[model samples]
Target: PALHRQRHQFVIDFVKQHKPKKVVDLGCSECSLLKKLRFHREIELLVGLDVNGAKVKKHMYGLAPISTDYLQPTYDQLCIELYQGSVTQEDARLRGFDLVTAIELIEHLTLADVGLFSAVLFGYMTPVAVIVSTPNSEFNPLLPGLRGFRHSDHKFEWTRAEFRSWALKVCLDYGYEVAFTGVGQAPQGQQESVGFCSQIGVFHRIGGRNGCNMLLDDDADDVFSYTLLYSIKY
Candidate 1:
């Protein structure tokens, strides 16, 4: 879970740096990052989207709530909206957020679906900034006893080179500038060469048509049903 902690901190730092007023988190299972962002009063609107309605329902209704120990008494005071939906589909509800994030999420999607998801995220939703993180396939070999992919659900993992190639293409197509970084440590000698255990890409829209007006050109079907889990406004 060290990798997750690293990613969480990395994103938290990103939020601090940008000080976005509105933010959306893709693949926001259990709203872990949302809980962390609650401490920052600058963020006035927080929305979380996930494909799993059941899980969102559980979290919102307290059947499987996120921890509140790090939360202030008024933490629940801010109404965090939750949506059950796929990131690869067009939704009028997701527009105008200043920031969007997908932490360790892309690998769970098929390569073709990855393209669709990209189109939806960059092409349509068109947030001012987007952050994505995924497993660095090249680093898998360095971990003791770990084999194959890092997780059973990952459809395909990408090496650092592969990830950069794809990320560059997305930026070029979407008129965004992107920067790459990593999470977790590499072996002492391999630190500079092999990079980190997780790869991250942050995209900033410079100029281009807002993707909401552009159609998602990929063929992958939208598998998730959009359901309102909860909408609380403080």
Candidate 2:
């Protein structure tokens, strides 16, 4: 899971550089990244969205435990919200966040669904910055015994060129500037040719809204949306 840790660190570092006050994580399954981010007291609001109702419920009811010491009242003061929703669908309820993230989640969706997801993330929510990470199909051959994509649920994985092409198109369509990077170390002999185990795309919105005006509907469909704002150990 070196790639997992590296992806997490990349996201953490990105957040540090941007210093956003409001943030949203698009595919926050267990809120693990949210837990790590809560340690930063400067973040005023943190929202997590996922497609699975059970996972959202677990995070809300405190069933999903986080590994961090219970301390710091300042951390308790930060707001943490969780919702169950699909990235492919447009939900006007989540708009105006300063930072939005979709780490290691795009490959789970089909190519067509990815288009819809891109529209939702870039057009609807429209955060100041967005971060995404996905498996680099080019590196699969370097992994021992790995014959196919990294995960069974992943519909398709893209090579570095493919990923860059798609990401560049999105940036152009959304009026955002983007940069590419990678996670994990390259294989020994292939270090000069093959890059990292995972690829990342960072997008910064151009002349976009900068406020944190996200509002959640209390009566929103129970199956689609749920909100929780509280603090807990990392």
Q: Which candidate number has the best TM-score?
A: 1
lDDT of 1 by residue, 1-234 (tens): 577888989888988898887888899887778877766757878888998877777776542235653355644345568898888787766765789989988998999889999888887778889899999888888988998888899998898899999999998897788999988888689877888899999888875335445444543553344677888655
* All-Cα superposition RMSD per candidate: 5.1, 4.5
Q: What stretches of model 1 exceed 4 Å from their correct place?
A: 61-77, 207-225
lDDT of 2 by residue, 55-132 (tens): 766766452334453445445446666777788876655666788989999999999999999888886677899999
Query: Which pairs of residues collide in candidate 2?
Result: none
Poorest stretch of ten by lDDT in candidate 1? 61-70
- TM-scores, all candidates, are 0.85, 0.83
Candidate 1 accuracy as lDDT: 0.80
RMSD of 1: 5.1
Please give the distance, in angstroms, between residue 105's alpha carbon in candidate 2 and its true position after superposition.
Answer: 0.5
